[model samples]
Target chain A: MANPTAALIIIGNEVLSGRTRDANLQFLATELGALGIPLREVRVIPDIEDTIVATVNELRARFTHVFTTGGIGPTHDDITSECIAKAFGVPWEVHAGAHAKMAAYYAAQGTEFNAARLRMATMPRGVVLIENEATVAPGFSMENVHVMAGVPRIMQAMFRALAPKLERGAPVVSATVHADGVFEGQIAEPLAAVQRRHPALDVGSYPYFRPGPVRGGVALVAKGTDAADVAAAADEIEALLVAAGGQAIRGEPRLDDNTTAKV
Target chain B: MANPTAALIIIGNEVLSGRTRDANLQFLATELGALGIPLREVRVIPDIEDTIVATVNELRARFTHVFTTGGIGPTHDDITSECIAKAFGVPWEVHAGAHAKMAAYYAAQGTEFNAARLRMATMPRGVVLIENEATVAPGFSMENVHVMAGVPRIMQAMFRALAPKLERGAPVVSATVHADGVFEGQIAEPLAAVQRRHPALDVGSYPYFRPGPVRGGVALVAKGTDAADVAAAADEIEALLVAAGGQAIRGEPRLDDNTTAKV
Candidate 1:
């Protein structure tokens, strides 16, 4: 059977305008891949309500799950919840559970739940809260859509809460071999053959612009849950590189941190 | 009036998997901003025909201009033209101009137009060819949507060709100042105030991370089209930073490389 798939929507004017370099997408993609839930789409849209609504609807309908980042903060541009509510044709009202959480958090801090901050509690109805230990306001999930914070630290926290709920597949395993002084084209066909031989494994050749002063080489990585298959594929690929007049050094077989191990 | 907006659709499965670090989005965003046409959205989709068709329709309807990258290569995944043609309910055919250009290019290289390579010539009807001086198969445009290559160099050439056709506003000018020994939060309010004072200009603060032996700092950038306004606002911002116990040093003004001065 095909792996479950997910999509990511990044909402923020800062990201689109090149003001903020997004680190969340990379993190999410790597995490999802390790879980064997392939991320199929990523949309970066400005914090425009209509754009967000359209994207959320389209992506949610297409993928098994959809994840959104940014615009969940207690600010004027933080319109992610409202847009998501609109997308699902639901009412945009203050979620009681979320509001109570926010109130308790502020009460502990000896601060009033200011109206501006209360906006963070406004989430879609029938959504499960994704805990955010880093901040008072937590991210929430409605249907298959999981809304998370934009801040990298808070996002990581929210994902930690949500990860346990999702069905994970066999852990993705990867083996890499470093081949120094090799051009990409020289090994493309041999790598393709290796991939063809091991249909279950994902064999990839990546040419890195490694800071030549320190270390520079082409890294061939074979990844899949089937350890023996990936190992055999890596051996074949490395041998091919060696025959192509390149020095191939076999590396460690490590668990891909991004993929989730089956519970 | 608000800036004329554009949207980009990146069609490929390779990118969303974290397999390819996306370079096209940044290049297009920066280039479009420099030409005064703000890029409002970017969507990276897999090679699914239905998804591409739906996104193209939605974005084309919402934005003034739409540009799509990838899926135009001479490979099996090169189905952008067919999908786009289907989306518009138009007949799909090989673009004669595109075919002629590709034929000549192959002939020059002493090769025939193979069937696989010829697939790049197919485009939606009534589209104008966006010249690709860097490669044989050119990107084509229909209505407001311009379909371009995915490779960075080729995409850049296609963008350059389309640049002249676009009606640009005053180019967004930008100036940067480096500040050492100051945390990002320390100057956020002052910078926000500077932005409030000059609403036209966009003031951004970026915190830099230095490795083991180097010192870290923050870079404040002021960007907008009105030179005197941005410069004056930047001056005031610098003064505020200096008064706030930060050492701010002006670096350089960003240049418009896409457009040439008509002397």
Candidate 2:
């Protein structure tokens, strides 16, 4: 609960058009949670100038830090950099440091340093560049809004480089207690009671259904900044599942099977 | 494009806390896009009542249709139905029809219709219930805002059942042309030229990376309501790729290889 809030703006027409499933949100969410900065909101908008500018401005003003992915590439649709500048009401121009680094990197790699390649260096005036080891076309951070490549690999790299610079908060930890054969309908009231008992910590009931009559299952998660408190809540939840005749599992269920639905 | 716009509000602390990756947004986007309803914005928000109430109200007012996933189960965390009622300034109560149907179905299945299971029958006043064939706990539609289960299978079923009732819109179609060895930097200018020529159709350059220097690749997509216009623009895009010496492939690149970066 003491964690700093963050918001992500995914600027891609492809995502909105359902051409691709986003891989960034989960990676960013897990990383931010580890950094003790809970991701509060994520907005997936198209590659429209007005939408990008407005979304960036709105989220930046609301959350402690804002991150954007996609539309920072060297293409006509990659207008996130310019739209970000418009959001902050600053001049969009090429950064000398970024330009030098990219030009030298491209030359060494024998990649062309054309006008489009140079567009990667251009950003809002007085911005700090977030370095990406891959492709060398660095993502930049204008104020609190960190602009990263939409590609998952590059986005992860930029995030790691920038993670240390973020403001710290109490690390959020979670304890999962699964009920393999327990239905939510049977234990909803008691789980509500458990939540009321631990007002500071959140008690989440995740119901995972297998084919043929749901298999009547649930995964209860107790999460908070305080270790002892979270553990206590988890214990109470585990007891609840046991009393309700659940074959309780200590850890989170395997997601690879893909049957687990976090209801 | 004469496509109707849709916004999705993913209500879950699990998604925000990084415990679970959301699977509903992409499914909804693809489904809505097929219906000629372009998904304009998607918000992933926490399960907090205030956030849910505020987001539902905001999105309902903006887009032609607003759909919500998650938090509709029979648990303490399942508060989306109540929050939606709050958003509409209506009293949250169990609809007699839903209650009766669920009760009969549970009795037939030899499942206990307990207090928590009864909660599934509750909804806002004057709402039309969206029936789910899988589970007797039907999702409800209040005006333009449709509420579905967070579970992907259940959500998809509910959407299909409700799809026929939705207003028809101009169907959005796409034509994809892939340039496997051509980078965005190489064709950014000419791609812009193609975009300018098309004007109406949105041309997106999706650069895919294959671990070694991006493999200098991109997948150009021309999307719009008009089939002929999209095809013509795609043809021009393919010509542009040919002129740039790209080994142009028709249609979208393999997402199965999991290297396509939808930038």
- Highest-scoring model, lDDT: 2
User: DockQ, in order, for the candidates?
Assistant: 0.18, 0.61
| Cα distance off (Å), candidate 1, residue B34 | 2.1
Give a tens-digit lDDT track for model 1, residues A1-263: 66778999998766776656677777888789889787888989877788799889988998888999887765445679999899998887888888887788778866657655677788887789997566668899999999997767678888988998987766667788866665444555576678789888756554443334423345677877888898898889789879878788887323222111000
Global Cα lDDT for candidate 1: 0.74
Model 2 misplaced stretches (Cα beyond 4 Å): A211-216, A256-263, B211-216, B256-263
lDDT (C-alpha) at residue B257 in model 1: 21
Output per-candidate TM-scores for chain A, rounded to 2 decimals: 0.89, 0.95
Interface RMSD for each predicted structure: 13.1, 3.0
Off by over 4 Å in 1: A85-118, A121-127, A132-137, A169-263, B1-3, B88-113, B125-127, B170-263
Alpha-carbon TM-score of each model against the true structure: 0.69, 0.96
Query: Model 1: which docking level applies?
Result: incorrect
lDDT of 1 by residue, B92-210 (tens): 88888888877887788665576656677888899999985666678889889999876666778889998899878677777888666554435655666787888877666544544
lDDT of 2 by residue, B43-91 (tens): 9998899999999999999999999998999898899999999999999
What lDDT would candidate 2 get against the real structure?
Answer: 0.85
